[model samples]
Target chain A: MGDPQLSGEQVRQRALLRFDRVERAVHWLNASLFLILVLTGAALYFTPLIALVGRRRLIEQVHLYVGLALPLPLLLGLAGSWGRGLRRDVGRINRWTEADMRWLRGLVDNAAGRRPSAPRPRLGKFNAGQKLNAAFVAGGGLVMLGTGALLRWYVPFPLSWRAGATFVHNWLAFMFVVVILGHIALALSDREALRSMLGGRISSAWAARHAPAWLEEASDQ
Target chain B: MTEHAGPADELPVRGAGAEQPVPSPAGDGTQEPWSKPIGRRTVLSVLGLGALGTLFGSHLQSGISSALNAVHANGIASLLPGGGQFTIYTVTSGYPAAPADYTLRVGGLVQRPLSLPLAELQALPATRLTRNFQCVTGWEVADVHWVGVRLVDLAAHAGVNPAATAFQFRSFDGIYTESLTIQQAHQTGAIVAYSMLGAPVTREHGGPVRLYVPSMFGYKSIKWLSAIDLVARPQPGYWEQNGYPIDAWISGHPPVQAA
Candidate 1:
């Protein structure tokens, strides 16, 4: 894939699959649902929205249905070729490496938009921060599913059980909002990264700059 | 449970089994309001509720509260607007018809097995209260006014057996049942209510008579009142059997279900 004579434009012209079709579809679907959930959930949680949000019952019904269906897109993605690939990605996220730790160490400067004069580390398809966010979302989503279900169904759970589940659900919602906002901000900061999610591909040079190690892996595949 | 207690603690607990046919104040520190015949006031309240609930149908809760606020002037019932429609979570759909061949059996571990008709209950001292009914799902119906005889009144009427410490409220629908500890029964706002926001409790709302424990979630308030069986230990309700918390609090995480 490497040619010493190739120009920068030639390198930028080659598009490699950064995110597969199934991955892009599921990711975007989940993103849209997450945004709606945040908006509706916020309206329900805060009191001012009661008067501001018309058709309160209708919105509530929509929130419940949308929340319950949040996992469907991922489930559908798994039914295709993504079942194994998704598991592999989860495993990849769970695994730790020196490069990941190094990326995390530099995350502070990265967040502040400061490109240090020192050499930066090469990363895989996902960096330490992205991996952490993914794991957090996955873990938080499961907790939400469990707690939300318990709250909805009147199974005679003790007040304490209900309270504990409720407490977790509430705090997790705040964290969910914060993390999702950060994710959106980071995505918007990188035009290529955001476009990759929508188009399922990124320019070869763009991949090399952001995820050099993963670019090599992709070329090998 | 958190220290945030509801009105559940103040009022005297009602028990079935008063030796006297008429409700006399029990001497055991429970001073109850005197019983009166269902007067024109009660009928007017029902009519007023019907006007509020039906006239402004979509705005039943808000309208009802506003209507009641005009008469009572108590600001508690008029504070927050009702959020959404009340969702009925029932194992089965069918409920027994009311005031037609209806009788509430106050038996099981009582001195007298009395089959009191609806009129007999209406004759008992009716206490009117407005409460914030919070569901476990975080939805709330504020200023919900209910009128009913106290559980202590019923227990005193039945002369509840001294040996029994708990009462399992059984619903006529057969699908639902719940047990309240003697301690819970003693709390304030524990009553077998028959009226909601002035009107008779609808079949959908657990009618004829239903157990209301303000401290606990709505499910603990057994609808379709049938029988109250007193026992040494609490038998888990239908939902309790289905893995719900036995000691469900509006604010606390109860320990695991007893083995």
Candidate 2:
């Protein structure tokens, strides 16, 4: 699919698929739900916010229904044949290789500005940080769902359990805000990565430098 | 003289071995009632029932506390059945119901103390108010139709003494209390409300009777209303003592005409 005038290297520099249509769609849906949950949760939790925007019952219902629907996109995506790319990415996130561990150690050393003991480990579809973020988000989502359910339908729970759920839910939500901000900042700093998320493509040159193993795997496919 | 005619002579003494005509199959007549061995199924059933009862009781207690403790905590009890978008709050762990012989005691500094039943309060002049109910925590139910006797009319009937400058409202829940100045009590929106939304106020919604202070935040309107003691001064209520303002006018301004 290269132009006849273009060299092989120039053709390789052309854009390649990073995320498929279904994966991109799922990611955007999840992001939108997260935004809604955070805003509604803040409106419910903050007295000043409540005073300023005073449709509390409506806001509360929005928060509840949106929270209940948070996991739908991912679950539905995984269920269909169209979700092959998403399912593959999920497997990559779940697996941690020796290279992944070395990448983590190298990351720590790089942040500390120390000299590399060995060459930087090649990355796959996701870096170690990305894997950790995915794991934490998935785990945190489950925790939030369990605790949110308890807080919402509190009658069957004990006082201590409800109290504990509230404590966890509040703290986790604050952590989510911080983490989301960090995620957005990091994504913004890497325009190519952010573009891939938004439009499902990245330059082969960008993929080769960042995820060489993934680039090789894609070429083989 | 009537000892022979008594019904005692016609009955047999059961389980009294010497007086028994026949023994039961399960136990000898000589066995005392307590000595009869219970069946395994019966014991298991009893244990099962006891467990079920304990579980139900615990959930019910938690549910009640969840509904009642909404005032102390943020974002609670809205999902409770029959709460109707209003967060139910109580100082106590449970919702106290009006007693079978419930009466509103109007005393303290009154010239003529009166104990009025629900019927008596309903019998008095009824004022229906359709105004917004605002909670200090910022939830509101608009245009609630309240039906009851006006507090001023009740005070007039009880003959409030000149020394009485305020009204101290007591709740059947026992822990909750609210105070209103004589002027606030005389406001057109203030009433000992028996009905709301065209029906008797529900127990969850502080039924039988509750103070409806439409001009002020909901905390000023006491629930499970059991008494209205004409007092000398406005006393800080349960919420007030817990850092809520005593004069919680909605939107930080008293109503222009109790609307």
Candidate 3:
């Protein structure tokens, strides 16, 4: 298929097929289940505080079911996207450089709109923000899954295993939720970026502006 | 186009001007017709599943509580022909002391015996973990935070002797005891915890220090850990002597099931 045209500003041609159908499906599926996991996980995580309202059992049960069901969607998502660009995207996000520290410093100054003009780095398909999120979810997801299995099966482990798993599972859950919230906030703020995921394409101009390297790579392809 | 569009501008764009492609039927071609749209139906089904789960979960919790209560009340009378002993203490809560004051002593067999205080312990790098807290008494508490040095960190600090096979944990109570193969103590989540829930350990819970091993039942996690003694021979702990499972990990043995 030829490149799609864009109308609004007449500045950007829309890019296409960055994510294959299977990739998109996995992304959306993971997104949906992750939301559900967050809800159920949050309910479970805050039980000590929530128990004051007297729904500990209810919250806990929901937590267990959600925890049990989480692996299916997660595994499906991982299997679908394993060797695809998504994995590369995850890798890109996790690659830390000195510039990321500058980006973080810019973030603080930029909030008050007094940020200094630093040389903009050529971000690939994923930026530091995206990479960190991906790492947190992927790494945290694996830990949660392994510990969760031991928990549900409750056998084959020594007592120490059970207790330690419980502790890590909870801590990771809270960290994941915070990262997810940040991810959503960024998506909402960047309208074109959000549309790119929804439509599986980004305006060429938008891509060039935000991800010049990715734009060049896509154009070369 | 207006910079700030009102609700009228927010309406779904049906024609050529829409920003994103309308979801295609082929996108979901493999799904059954009934699964189409993922709208109200999916939402309801998810909610319905959650509700059903809640119902079953409550039943499980209640059943578990009743069984544990029976065991707690009657002192394992139903399981062991000879009744087991029960000790009930009032609930007390506070943070545990820092590792500086904490002393992890490993004495008993082999060469290179050691006792390091909290400062010496913290001087080495620390391993922090956060995980769920499940009580065998029938309450499942998730997300209990723990920060401390890992058991491996300690073992590395105090050099393990190859001849040492079993590690016995002695708690402050002087009553509770648990043992692990030297290899098992080196697992990823195994740690000697000085703090829980972001604070120091509390007395009610195992304070001063505790041995946290993730994967086994809570009882296997010895609380109020006073000392860790390595021995060449297997020594039965208080619980083991009392007929509790030496491992005590969750083996899916149904509560109160006939042995």
Off by over 4 Å in 1: A1-9, A54-58, A82-88, A108-119, B1-135, B138-213, B216-259
Model 1: how many Å of interface RMSD? 27.8
- Candidate 3, residues A148-198, lDDT tens digits: the string is 665666545554455455545544565677777888898899987777677
Clashes of each: 35, 0, 27
* TM-score to native of every candidate shown: 0.49, 0.50, 0.42
Residue lDDT tens for model 2, B41-156: 23234334433433343344444444645653454443322132455554454456789998989999988899998888888989988986765533345578899888888998
Q: What docking grade does candidate 3 earn?
A: incorrect
After the best TM-score superposition of candidate 1, give how far the Cα of residue B28 lies from its true spot, in angstroms: 83
Off by over 4 Å in 3: A1-11, A16-18, A45-83, A87-118, B1-134, B137-259
DockQ for every model, please.
0.01, 0.01, 0.02
Tell me how many residue pairs clash in candidate 1. Answer: 35
lDDT agreement of model 3 with the native: 0.54
The residue-by-residue lDDT of candidate 1 on A1-221, one tens digit each, is 65312436866787887777777788889989988988877666554454355343456567778889998887776555555455444444444444565676687777888875345755666677776676567556756766677666635554444445544565568778888889889999998889988887788888777777666555655
Write one digit per residue (lDDT tens) for candidate 3, span B1-259: 0111121122212111111123446556522111111122222343344334333443443354455557765644322211111111211122222344567787765356677675665576777877655454323445678877777656656676777787888875545678876666654357888788788777645776787776555666777787887777767766466444665445443224221
Q: Determine the TM-score of chain B of model 3.
A: 0.57
Worst 10 residues of 2 chain B by lDDT: B1-10
The order of the candidates by TM-score, greatest first, is 2, 1, 3
